[model samples]
Target: MDALTAEEADPVADEHGAHQRGGGPGRRPSDAQAVVPPGALSPAERDRSWSRLGDEDFDVVVIGGGVTGAGVALDAATRGLRVALVEARDLASGTSSRSSKLFHGGLRYLEQLEFGLVREALRERELMLTRLAPHLVKPVSFLYPLSHRVWERPYTAAGLLLYDTMGGARSVPGQKHLTRAGALRLFPALRRDALIGGIRYYDAQSDDARHTMTLARTAAQYGAVVRTSTQVTGFVREADRVAGVHVRDVESGAETSVTANVVINCAGVWTDELQRLSGSRGRFRVEASKGVHIVVPRDRIVAESGLILRTEKSVLFVIPWRNHWIIGTTDTEWNLDLAHPAATRADIDYILEHVNSVLATPLTHDDIEGVYAGLRPLLAGESEDTSKLSREHAVARPAPGLIAIAGGKYTTYRVMAADAVDAAAADLPNRIPASITDKVPLLGADGYHALVNQADQLAARHGLHPYRVRHLLDRYGSLVHQVLAEAADDPELLKPVPGSPDYLQVEIVYAASHEGALHLEDVLTRRTRISIEYPHRGVESAEAAARLMGRVLGWDDETAREEVRVYVARVEAERDSQTEPDDQTADARRAAAPEARPRLEATA
Candidate 1:
């Protein structure tokens, strides 16, 4: 389906009756109304989007669709600015989706003496948990292993004390000290030699991809024209300033010009590339730091809480994500395909070796359910070591009407967005309003607390198990009702998808309709998490899932088969390459597979 033609159908108006007044089912009065549904963007609608883009000019145009760009669009739209957000691919298709999934103040930052960054992130974390997106972000506890008996406890305790005193930590429990035996009681999976004791502290986590998609949808609800699979081919310059952009409908190969008074580049790792396109000379460079994570079944690691152990290079986390545990992250420089970062065998071995050090029953490569890699948009420093580089982001106005933001962590996205918009506002003639996003709750956040309390009733009403309903609510909040409504229309949608037992068929349909999912990879890998949660990476279920999506995306039999084939091949290549020793060989093997069409390339 093409993006340009699809926009002309005004699918948003048709699927969600034009006169619909309040927020959709399961939403509160204060929540933003649902402007589009999971099935709103039909094939015809997608083919017509480019023509619509030429009809109107925006005050600000955001170049990337990662967390930062989505946040910028939401902020601009809420402030009554005419805004447009264009992504060359699906929303959150880059580093945004492949994050560590923590909305944290960076406990390690305290040791680095980055007090301001920690405080800012802590404030944003508080806002997200309490006011903004209560339905999506929640508290998660982590045990910091103490290898030494004496100074380790006191040193860690002091840090935890400071962490607790932070603004956002108020909603969660304070840190607790546990003896070796006490710690083992909480996590029997740990090896006796893994630690001398532990200190438990709190952080928060969310589905990064979903949160980013929600941010874009929320911006659309506030009157921003949000479109995905629309790539910015080049900049539209007027005199010496960037006036707008020339965007190509990636799916259809049709181009359109979008005029904007200001352009904010939030392309993460692609920051430098985008700046070059805009003819803006930037002061800093963004280096791609590759981090790979492995996912295993929850049963493999028996623990009451998550574990965080120190590695030779950086910290290693055994995070609890739904029914699975996510263990990861090796920091190394990557100059491979940014669209799909492959984890070499060495990367896998590194993670497995470190994580195995703490496990009573060692996990082999066969035990790994999934492997995924993401690039960190780190600001290049003098040191060659990527780990020592700054996690802090920078906002730059390299040219008139062009503002670029890069190098921040996920937790501090809002601050980065606000600063980017603030910089762009200087070029505009009108007086821009101050950011009220702190008080503006995301689409599903307003009534989340109330709906969570009624989980049992909601489950019974939907004929789902209570725990299943709780899971949906946690991910979608009040919007779970919208998902249920889709199932209400088709009984088959209520059934769980084959292979991936964790998600219902309706979730796949919702991805295309409302979440701006353009391709099969977007649905499986990002919108729903079958790619990371399932051992086969959804390869076994690819055909069935593709058929379901085909019904909505208007994919013919041949196209459906091709999508399944592509997704399957992607999985196979990743799995096969993980057996290769290093990044160069693994990257070459993974690169042998066909590149994803309509790829979203990030730029500054």
Candidate 2:
């Protein structure tokens, strides 16, 4: 897949002009990333970033470390603006980490006639797969099972044909029509009578959490001051215009201020709350829609390709992950907790019921290893149905020095970020350069292909198995050398973690030392993905991970023990919550678990 420039790519995306343009980026494919070992988020780096925040007068300050905020910071930094990114918790600790892990053009949107959104998303997917982060985003095939007779086949085929050509779908193989027998051969797990035929199409998938983390790290390489465990408590106002942010270190509860020419809010579901704190009437309302998914072992579903089924309410995807299948996403209104959205028994049952309808062997509760829930910040509309809510984003300057961006899918975060920075340009002094992030490959992207070719030689040098080295290469790209460097002194760091043997022990150490993990949850949940991959959901690995984190973060034995206790309680809470009847009970149970980073009251 060759990444094409916007002008050469999809003319429809350009013609519609759905997303606001950032002045105009002077970018090209030949641009190289600046060489730097972006300050690792060790204890020392945290102090350094915090000190820099207190001392520097930045051009832009981005509040929210989700994909959009990280993208915003990167966009600003790549354009030669001084930038600071502060997250209340870990990066991608919210919706960014909890997505379906797809980098797809919304196929369902085609039904709603949202050609512009689909075109934009598909173009973005092209960039990620080809040029931007090939190591992170990968291609996957899906079988769209057809239930009805002739009309269904033709209708679906027409849609797939459009999907194939629009937004540079030529990057991957076009959709292939398959007979019922052929479909069954590809996915033997499906019941024979489940479909008449199917369409096999190519789409892209990724590790959302890792991609977001890498985005922030890449921004840091471009001189963006990235700080996690830092919360924006209130807005600093100089008369009517917003001047800066009043911040609190979630770890120390210490108060400080970050002065910036402009502030951009990409707080995801917390956008409304952040706007309220700024004392500005938000341009629009944000509705939180809860989505739930479950993880089951791969052997349970014997298939060569993934399956996408149509539900009465929406679509359900049985996506293939390594060693497991991620099946889910139940959409409904959520008003309880913004931080922790819990998946109830009903949500699990709904997913199981829909997925099992086609499976030859039904998957029971015992088959489920893990479950997670995330909130989608849908822009409110006249329709009461949350499903009808638009994924198209809106950017606004509600007050001077304040810019708010919200309402978009995970696929188009870059476009949204570009629009946001463009909207904040009014607060900037001179004419700022356009977003050059389009040309800037992320931190590990530059040498990814060459490293993949040298995997065997690299593995021999590192004294690790070929398979293990390849895994590291995919996850860290060229930065895998940095991770392996930790094992120079302690060779045992190369050993697999006690309970989670799929990942090396060194990964735990690297998560805290380099990836800005403030607590064990950051390692288990986001950094290494021990939580969702195992049957126990990191319960068995909590103490082991805590030990690794403790050594890096200077946590005493008691502190490490407490961290373990908190993680175990979190796993148990999620487990208990899944047994609950509805969202209210499940939210209550999930919220009962203690927060790893305690939030403080704001004093702006």
> Which candidate ranks first by TM-score, i.e. highest?
2
Q: Report the lDDT tens digits of candidate 2 across residue range 273-346.
A: 99899999877789999999999999999999999999999999999998899998899999988888999999
* Candidate 1 residue lDDT tens string, 52-158: 57877789999999999999998998888988888887789889999889998887788888877788888888888888998899999898888986787888898
Cα-based TM-score, every candidate: 0.91, 0.92
Instruction: Report lDDT per candidate.
Output: 0.79, 0.85
Which regions of candidate 2 fall more than 4 Å away from where they truly are? 1-36, 381-391, 600-604
**Relative to the unseen true structure, what is the Cα RMSD of model 2?**
8.6
* Model 2, CA-based lDDT: 0.85
> How many steric overlaps does candidate 2 have?
0
| Each model's total of backbone clashes | 25, 0
lDDT of 1: 0.79
